[model samples]
Target: MKQSGNSKQFAKKDGEACPRGRPREFDTDTVLTSASQVFWNHGYHATSIDDLCKATGLLRGSLYGVFGDKHGIMLAALDHYAEGSVARLAERLNAPVPAEEALRNALLHYARVACALTGERSCFITNTTLEMQPGDEELRTRVAAIQRRMATLLAASVIRGQASGAFNSTLDEKAVGDFLLCVMQGLRVLGRVAHKEDALIGIVDVAMRALV
Candidate 1:
């Protein structure tokens, strides 16, 4: 005879599976994705182990076992975010579309995502730079390296556009790239302040025009 199993065993808790086992092998990718979102929504200082567990649906022991500590998890999450952001930007830069149009669309997309956040306005790297202690040289270096890489990517795109005559060749590549980065960060700040979408769009339009 077939028997019915206990419903409580398969019940969902907080929208996550209430699975039982040796806690299941950790999926690094999924954990990082969830952790990144949590870090994005709540700055490093504000996010706790409990917050991480809730976001990843991992128990406290599982989290510690896989990540070692909060800092380890944060570092992994930051790496994941950085890779995904660069990949998305690269897709736009590599597109066959006109360079000017590609750059503009990329910037606009970034603004939309930034503003979508409920309370935060800036990118996680930017936020971390502002909040992390200066004495934490490792984190500072990591953030700086990531920022430099981003600027380099932007500069390369600008250089390509200039060479193809799609962008203003007269503008300095380094300066233009730096300017764009600042514009993106500024939009994130404005987002935190709950600025209107039109206001951010206006800024993007002006910045894009300057590049072309």
Candidate 2:
């Protein structure tokens, strides 16, 4: 996985300890990055505690002591990825460029990620949703909330585009946002099998034209 450029923003001061543990020697953000990469590379079910331990360079005792259990760690990882993704979206949408252009750039950015040469080449939240069991309401709820936040950001951009006459003013902003969300998710799913950036770009072009 690409090391998060925002790691330092989330980094704990060195040597912070969990509620009931020795002082932590490892950086928490760094650990999560590694753990998230492991989860991203391997589905939740296929991932083992040993894999996490090896990836994070922590012993099982340390992992459990810090995160409580594998599930806790997974939640932490999800939060880590989700927070970064939403923050990046906000940054992109808030850029000084025309809103329509920002939206296009955002779509193209994620489209490229969907076809990345390494990592999962899919949204972490989407991957988690697919692996979540029916009984996993908490997991489902978390994913749903994150997706909703993403949709809201997209909707805001749509509204901006409409204000600037870059998009159809008659269209419902929320519905358009939802439509884009579906397209972005579809790109990730299709990219996994096709691994084709050109195909993903074609979908993005369709999405952009639809907004216009």
Candidate 3:
């Protein structure tokens, strides 16, 4: 959508005082959070510029100025969600608790979020990844890289568990990490159709067996 007529340009000399009552600057993180929720609720292909504008409270001009286009907004939202996910995983996995317990807690955390009352159930990353077309190599690659980052964090935890005699030493650490990643993604999908929190937690419980 094109910008509304209300959008105006401002010009000032270098030392001029700032215009009074200027609109507050947009918080990019806040906008991305709202946009990410819109994308999660409606897959990337289905979310329109109007939807984003409504969710983020930004005019079309401001949205385009900040993100360039619909695809740009989605990309920014995906990166925002992925960065937060990685940070949370690192915090949980790097804690002083036993590796198995730490991993279980991590899985349980996803379970809780999946079961939350939010109308949308799918994860922002998982939903966006699944919606990607075959020709979207750049998008596919970006998704792969993010998954690898999370998997690496999981693998490191598994390796630590192996070293400490807490996890199955016979299992390949990387493979177990990949498996956990799959389980987490599966929880996101299951969360879409299942409302019962116990169902998701049960899956986490079953997934923990891999560490044993």
Cα lDDT of all candidates, in order?
Answer: 0.76, 0.81, 0.81
Residues forming the 10-long window of minimal summed lDDT in candidate 3: 9-18
Q: Tell me the tens digit of each residue's lDDT in model 3 across 1-212.
A: 12222124211211222246253357788899999989888889889999998999866766776677898898888888899989999999989998888989999988888777353646888788778999988788889999999999999999988999988899998888899999988887788778689999999998887578
Candidate 2 vs 3: which has more TM-score: 2
Model 1: residues >4 Å from true position, as ranges? 1-24
Task: Write candidate 1's Cα lDDT for 1-212 as tens digits.
Answer: 11122223323322333356223455778889899888877888899989999998776656655556898888878888888878888887778887777888888876786678755736776777778886878787778778777777788889988999988989999988888888877777777766477778888999988877
TM-score of each: 0.80, 0.84, 0.83
Tell me model 3's lDDT, rounded to 2 decimals: 0.81
Instruction: State in Å the error of residue 119, model 2.
Output: 8.3
How do these models rank on TM-score, best leading?
A: 2, 3, 1
lDDT at residue 141 of model 1 (Cα atoms)? 78
The residue pairs that clash in candidate 1, if any, are: 121-188
lDDT for model 1, please.
0.76
